[model samples]
Target: MDAPVSTSPRPWSPPPDASDVVKSIHAMLHPRNIVVVGATDKPGNYAERIWNNLIKYGYEGGLFPVNAKRESVWGVPCYKDFASLPEPPDHVLVLVPARLAVQVIRDAAASGARSATIVTSGFSELQDEESQRLAAELQQAVRETGLAVTGPNCLGNLSAGEKLFTNIDDRAVTMVQGPVAIAGQSGAIVMAIRQTLEDRGVGIGYMVTTGNEAGLETTDLMNYFVVDPSIRVIVVYLEGVRNTKAFRDACKAARAAGKPVIALKLGASEGGRAAAMAHTGALAGSIETFDAIATREGVIRVQNLDQLIETTECFVHAVTPKGNRLAAVTLSGGKRGLLIDAFDAVGLNFAPPSPGISAELGAMLGPGSIVGNPLDAGFAAVVDPTVYMRAIKLMIDDPDTDIVIIDAELPKAPHELRERNLRRVNDMAGEASKPVIYVSAMSIGFTDYTKELRQTLPHVTVLQGLDRAVTAIKSLIDYAALPKQVPDVASSSKPSARATLEKILKQAEGAALDEVDSKKLLKAYGIPISKEAIAQSAIEAIKIAKSIGFPVVAKVVSPDILHKSDIGGVMLNLTTPAAVGKAFADITARVKKLKGKPKLEGILIAKQVNADLELVIGASLDAEMGPVVLFGSGGLDIELMKDVALAGAPLNEADARALIGRTKAGVKIKGYRGKPALHEASAVKALVGLSNLISDAGQRIASIDINPFLINPKTGVAVDALIVLNNEAARQSFDKSTKGKSTKKGGGH
Candidate 1:
């Protein structure tokens, strides 16, 4: 069938110049010829701090300081302006006031500077009209001159690869150079990540903070890092993303490149969203949507900075295991118990050794040693260090073990003995394809001695804190277990179907659709709905019920009312014409007493079909993700139970089945005790059908509710359907404005 007809503004996109983006990033990362505007001799000023960092960090490139009042800044030549510089520099650091930032950028651009870092505040982040106007001018400058800008309210960036330290961080002078690259929206968070990694003797390859993100967003930097050959892992400190499509694409690219992207996302709570909005001018979109995309794109999300650091460190050294089975070896029984609990908490299974292997281990350790999973080798390993090494090797070689964890007190061992043990394990890891982790049982902090060991033996993953180590491994396994992304099916609404829906929506205008029209719209998409007819009077109702057959159901139809049962507007199991007539009269009388005296259109007569289970399938529009689908248990307590699974729309059969499997009702639907298993493919078909409707309608639809859909052994049929249109109150941009005109009142199911 032909795709839906009409125009829906496409999802947001980034800047359109690829070459310009690369050149800009290159200039930011490798600014050999630099000019610092607003330089001064004031000791505590931003300019002085930046100059000190450049000098102390041994920047081996030419630097020119711009200041009309000073002759020089810390013995470096000071130019009066960009025009006065010896030659046009590649980059400029603007330390001027917010009002003058645009003018400075204009001058820098005129002088052929490809990129500029505006170290000024008071832009759209302030959320005021005047500040927004200033931000607009700054954007104009970049657009008109083809120059790349980092921030108008930001804490600049640092490049370790080129020794180009442009940020106001003085302590960055001593940062070690390594393979991990960090891109963050918050400058302070980036600095903190660098310090935390540096304290552990982990060097950084590149560090960047896209403050305010006026010209280049964090996703832009992520896209750059995914392709950079030197970056093995990418770390992100996220508040929000302006362009969601770019962020998702970047995550996919990173996954395809075999690089792990670790993120610490804030704004999970309402208070956090408020704080995040005040801090940065971002929407702080739904946490649920973020989670769905993160899982789909293979981005590893963490709760806190510590988890972020721990996960990144683990990925740097550990190999992705083929399965979630873990073989843990701890010296202490108490520690072994702790490992079992931790592993179970994170859903990691313990792999039991085979009988032959168990016998060999039992003979090696002698009596009293537990030879099963979570093996406590007793004092045999401590007495003879060679024994522990041999046991570790045996676990690594076991077919059932995909990950090997050894909890040891390395600091207590003799220095030489510790070295020999770690070195052998590291060498063994090189030969074996599986990952081997060394968990510090003592909960010790990193010291010079440990730093030396990490630097010397980089292959063995050494992690501190037992709980943190297990949590990190769980994350690794989760990442490894993600199924390959399924190619999307051709699920768009056909032109004829779209036109039918549009006509129904137009006829109803801003009102809620009655069951007849709702069912009509759904039926166009091939979704099964119960056979029924609308009857305007008691005589007609009785006739319709008889035609539908005995044991029919009747519900009041109204454009002004929702939730017919709440108002006594529904009657079920009509066995005779007398019952149908009386039920219709009773529903009409009951709805008349409702507070607002809702308008009653007619009574619906439907054939009652036999069903083994009830299910709910729905779809709606999300501000960020566009379209979203939901599946869960259906009935009066669907809200109380809240056992629903949600995902972004345009779903294939695989995605639909995954969503269905996450609910308690799904378990019952599979087969409860002696009950026969219902056809799950029926539910999957309904979900995909709903997804297509949402995608085709796009922003024109407000919401959809299909509750208590009956599922029998052969098929699932919609017994009731409710569709709400995108009225003035339901517009996507309704909530952002502080002032608005009054809107018409309407009801939705």
Candidate 2:
């Protein structure tokens, strides 16, 4: 019989809906022909192991070996180089030194090979100038030749779908082919996860290690997995992603395809971030940014390896609970207490047995048996084991039960009895709409037969520990409840506002806009600001303060100073003209004493705002995810606690309302602990306006900082404003302001 031919076209030969780059990646992952570069007769070498694994795994493709010093390698005829091959192979595994890897890729490209896996290191991971230079060279070769490369320092990939195994581990040759596709930056993690999954009998379809990611990133593989018919879930062990746009696109694609992506991303902690940077040369982005994107994209994030495996095992049952309500049944009363505590800690709700159901259980057990959520069946289960099944069946059939969890000390029981009990439970679960997860409370002491029972069982999950079980259960519920709406990330609108903002940004100077001009920009977006004026001297400051009214606020205006109060640059409650005049002189004198001798624009005199609460609202552009909005407690504590909530910008009022509600600061705004309830809607409106500002001037604006935006029941007033512009925008604004300007001041808000 002849080997089957791949329907997939060659690299650079794209289908109608795909591009050449995507076609190239597809061929690399699922190739029909492969040639081993640097193939040798030496036993246990990387090339020898890969070549033998291909044959052992029953790879149905043309295999050619390239070895300059040998005529034959491992009983296969060896060619001298790519020029000597009979035909162009679909992919090549280049096991050469890092310095020579680029040349090998160029040779492969010239020979018409679509892809090459450069199994070499000493590139970007070193975090030095020379390594980075080499990495850049590799990237240039890939871009110039249009060849898809997996790594310059990586463990090769394995495609069980094609019976292709090139990873260092020969065990991959025998792993079962299934729906899960795993991709990562660390080769060890990729192989470890595969082994863990395979140990539990969960087969994998594709496993790829994107070391250094100079040419291909994890996102690229995710995008491909989204469309692959053989995959139902995508798992990734990520340090970080340099290409955030690609990550977002791939996540969205997976969501659209109804494939869930499970990510175990590192870099949430300082130590983890350092380790990740050292290991993969990944500049870990803000953890908050990663979390926000994950939430918006419906990607499931787990903390550790244990959760990864357990959650995946649970997903294999493929049951999506309708709600978080859980019905738990345990054989031991002590175990019931532990289970209840674990569930409560993670916010899983309990479904208490109805009165009639409780009464029935009471009569059946006769007495001393509690019939409630975490139901502790009577000691009758010890003598009559049928009682366990009966109690569990009743709970499973409850109308309020979205999930059923059973905890049992199976290791203490005879294997025969435990297997019988579990099999009956499995049968019951298989027929129900909700998923059933069994908690092995004493998993450490479990018999081998019991462990085997868990591994080999169909549609049955035996989670090891109580805490992990609760988390898995909660994650299952959260995934089921993920909102279906596509995320709206700053859709372009407000053409008039965009034009005005662009003009203003184009005319600004230095890094920041002074208070007067910042207020002018905010007013354009409909945010209310106190009437104010910039006064050039003491007499001018007195006159402006009087016009604003008595008890006005005076702040020193400068392009350099960020925190006015810290530098004694602010004076509040200036009731008299003399006090206003004195405050202006005092601010100027203090600012002059500060280091760097900041250029003071003028004294900004504004009517003091009286409000029920103070709030801080800010907007900034994230390098990875574009615009982001921040809301937090205002006043001096803003920096102390840093208690803030964040959301991607260009949001509507409803989204803004949800965003503000996420923080402790928002709690106080809504009348927490005997405090009067301030109008929260006013703040929401201000946030929406800020979002508009970001969307309108995103290219020109770097950040917008508004602290202590006074808020009352009906309105929010910007007490102060500071807008930072990008360099080009700042330079443009500086040129405009410096040319033929007398006072270096703008009109009032």
Tens-digit lDDT string for candidate 1 (102-198): 9988888888888888777788777689988998998888788777678766677777766668888877444455778898767888888988887
Q: Which stretches of candidate 2 lie over 4 Å from their true place?
A: 1-22, 127-130, 170-174, 268-285, 409-414, 441-451, 487-493, 673-676, 726-749
lDDT, model 2, position 247? 85
**lDDT, residue 64, candidate 2:** 84
Q: List clash counts for every candidate, in order.
A: 0, 4
lDDT for model 2 comes to 0.75
lDDT of 2 by residue, 230-337 (tens): 788889987765666778778877877767788887753221111121101012235665676665776888889988887776776647788888888877788888
TM-score of 1: 0.88
Clash pairs for candidate 1: none
